[model samples]
Target: MQRLQAFKYELMPNGEQQRNMRRFAGACRFVFNKALALQKDRQAQGEKKLSYAAICKALVEWKQQAQTLWLNETPSQALQQSLKDLDRAYSNFFAKRAAFPRFKKKGQRNSFRYPQGCKIDQANSRLFLPKLGWLRYRNSREVLGEIKQITVSHHAGKWFVSIQTEREVAQPVPQGGIVGIDMGIARFATLSDGSFIAPANSFKRHQAGLRKAQQALSRKTKFSNNWKKAKARVQRLHARISNVRKDFLHQATTAISQNHAIVCIEDLKVRNMSKSAAGSAEQPGRNVRAKAGLNKAILDQSWFEFRRQLSYKLAWQGGHLIAVPPRNTSRTCPCCDHVSADNRRTQARFECVACGLDENADVVGAINVLRAGHARLACEVNAEVMASAAGTHRGDLAA
Candidate 1:
């Protein structure tokens, strides 16, 4: 099957190239913001919003109006690609495929993506752009498939290039056994076969430095050079946290996918589950002032991203990903179908009232997820059989 994938490589750029890239990214951001503001104003005034064609025209006019704006760091196709992205984002939003466009704030944006021509080669780790010369890259992994598009962005004060590719991935059924997974903030993930992946709070480990960087950023005056530097420090720290989380997810997902023919997991609404209530004025969840800090830690778990990756990776490997409904999977006893919130007294302990079976809460959830998956499979089989019989009867009547 054909799949779209990306290969990201760190860029080795001199000061000049780095500055140029920054300028290009800034220009793109400026155009997007300007267009969005204009669009909003037009809406308020009851005028038709400017389409991308109109925006592209404005960009051409602006580029011609002042060479100084784009002189140091303008790619020929970059601005055009940016306009396309704005259009696409709005299109997706209007189609209800994505959330509405949010204004891009300074220092919060990290990436920009644009289209590429056919001259790019993933094997050689080289790309030829309109004005930019044949740029060589230091690739960390082998670029897996055909290059579709390329995006160059800065993260952690470093520039990197990502090549989107399309390739045919062979999905062969595995010989391994089936397993079910239950994901939670307390224990990351628990498998049906009794194996568990513990939550390694990478954010917690790096919170001290992150807090220091954030505080330093907050103290600096807005729009000042010092503030920019401090903001970069904060960005770098966040990038580190993201990298750590991604690495952990990749490792866990690979281990689970490789060992299982069928993987079942709870379809949890993580956003709803991550909320913590307010306590008395004396004591909050962690510290009253640190409410946002604690919340960030919970959000950083990236449970949703984990499930997304597991779904596709397992599909690509010819394994199944069964997302059972988020019923009382934690409290329901897989052995006897009993469900009660009281069954779970602590984060670690689970005692079933119906069956008297005791197990880890996460393990119980995993077992329940597996049972749900099995039940779903059986129901699907029966449905198929009924459909077949119905079709046969209809054919006989027609005859």
Candidate 2:
């Protein structure tokens, strides 16, 4: 089996190299924004949007032009990559996978990719790119597999390189254990086997400090040195919180994926669940503030990230992940199959009115999810068997 993975490391660039990188990133951003503007103008003028090839042709002209000759200083490949990214963004928009491409902003997620001509010197912890050569990085882990592409990004005033590689590995054999997971704000995840993972609430833990930093930033004059410093502080804090949440999710997902051959979880619609409760002007929403706080808490849990991590990791481990409908999972009784709004007496407790079986609400939810997953798997097996039998019967008839 072949797998693709990315290894990221913090880059240590000299002053000249750092300046070049910043310029390259800026040039890429400029190209993307300029191309988007051109596309919009052409659309307004009743002309078809420029294709990637056309944009590249225009880019070559722009680099040679007297006014925009500075574009020539950056690597031509990086500029072409920016055009490719814009094209992809447009494609995604047309496919309804994402919103329309927007103009790139300065100092926000500055990055440029090197599709080819990237070399790694692991022994010396150095990386070489097309134009920027011999950049040192902190080799936290060994880079595995054949390198395909490299992306350099600036985040929280730090530069990093991400190397994507493809490698062949033996497919893992299923370990034959199945578990269902119930995710919530109180506990991160509750398993059908009665084990639970606690919520880290990383954002909540750092919320106060972040709030203070933002307040200080607001007090500083706009575009002042102090304001810039304050903004950096807030960005660093946000980055720290994100790192903590990601680390916690990865650890939990790895454990769950490794332990279970089949993992079932609720198909949660997080966007709808976290939408603001504020209503139209004529019809005011009640408990708007309470709903807002609940939305924050729900987002803070990072349920989607947990599920995403579990899915890919499970696939890599030769396990299966099933998403069952979330409807009535908490209300349904696992022992008696009784489902009622009143069955969930509180957030943490569940009691069936039909058979009077009581259990933890999350645990009951996990059990119901497991049952649903089993039913789905059984149906799939039955269908496959039926298809095979039908094929054999058809063969006999032909004979």
Candidate 3:
């Protein structure tokens, strides 16, 4: 099976290299925004808008003749590809997969990636690029198999490189165990085996520091050096929260994938569910304070990220990750298939009105997921066998 894997490394670049990286990122961003503006202007004037290739030509001209300052800096083809990425993003938005392309704000930007023409050789802990020469990397994890491409990115005022590679898939290790997992804000996840992973609430733990940093940033004059420093501080806090959440997800997914041959979960519409309504004196949930805190906490649960990790990891391990349509899964009783919204009296309690079976609400959800998985498995097996028989019958007829 073909799979894409990324190996991330922390970069140890000197002052000049760091400055060059920043300049390249700035130049790419400048070209993209300028091209977008030019395109919009031409459209407004009823003229033919510039194509991506045309915009790239303009960037080349600027680099060569107009601005000889960055002439020695040397531009990469990857920089040109950034504009294409922006175009694709806008295209996706038009196709309704994403929101309208937002003009990237200076301070709010995290990092840019060298999506093309980059190389990494972990054996030497060095990365080569179009402009910058081979730079040393602080690689901790072993780069698996053969390298394909390397991407340079920055986060929390720190530089990092990601190496994408391809490798032979490992042989499947039999676990013989199956599990159903229910993810929620209150308890993170509850499994079919009646075990639960408690919510870490990493954001909540670091909220005070983040808020203070943001406040400090707000007080700093915009575009000033102090503002930049404060902004970096805030970004560092955000990065800490993200790191904590990612670590938790990695550990949890690894544990589940290792122990379970088949893992079932709900296909939750997290984005829809996470949407907030305005709260007033009468509509309390939609109020600013309530919505901000509650929604932030729920989003920090990172259900989507957890599901995403489980998906690829399980596939790599030859384990199955099953998602069931999330219809009345929590309301229905696993034992008797009794469905009632009132079955859940409280967030933690689930008492089936018909079967009179009491259990943890999350456990009930897990069991329902397991049943759904089993039903799907049976259907798939039957479909495969039927297809096989049909193929054999056709062969016999041809004979």
Best by TM-score: 2
How much does candidate 2 score in TM-score?
0.97
lDDT of 3 by residue, 256-361 (tens): 8888889999999888877867646775653667766767887999999999999988887889988999899899988888899989989999999998999999
RMSD of 2: 1.3
Collision count for each candidate, in order = 0, 0, 5
> TM-scores of all models?
0.86, 0.97, 0.89
Sorted by TM-score, highest first, which candidate order results?
Answer: 2, 3, 1
Question: Please, what are the lDDT tens digits per residue for candidate 1 over residues 1-399?
Answer: 788888788877667667667777887777777778878888899998788889888777777766445632567577777777888988999999999787777655555565766366557777665455566788667877877777888777777888888998775776577778888767788888888888878888898999999988889999899998898888878888889999999998888787787888888787775666566688755554566555666676888989998887787777888888978888888778877998898888999877788888888888888888999978889999999999999999999
Task: Find the 10 residues in a row with the least total lDDT in model 1.
Answer: 67-76
lDDT of each: 0.79, 0.93, 0.82
For model 2, residues 109-163, the per-residue Cα lDDT tens digits are 9999988888999999998998888999999999999999899999998999999
Off by over 4 Å in 3: 42-55, 64-72, 108-124, 170-174, 279-292
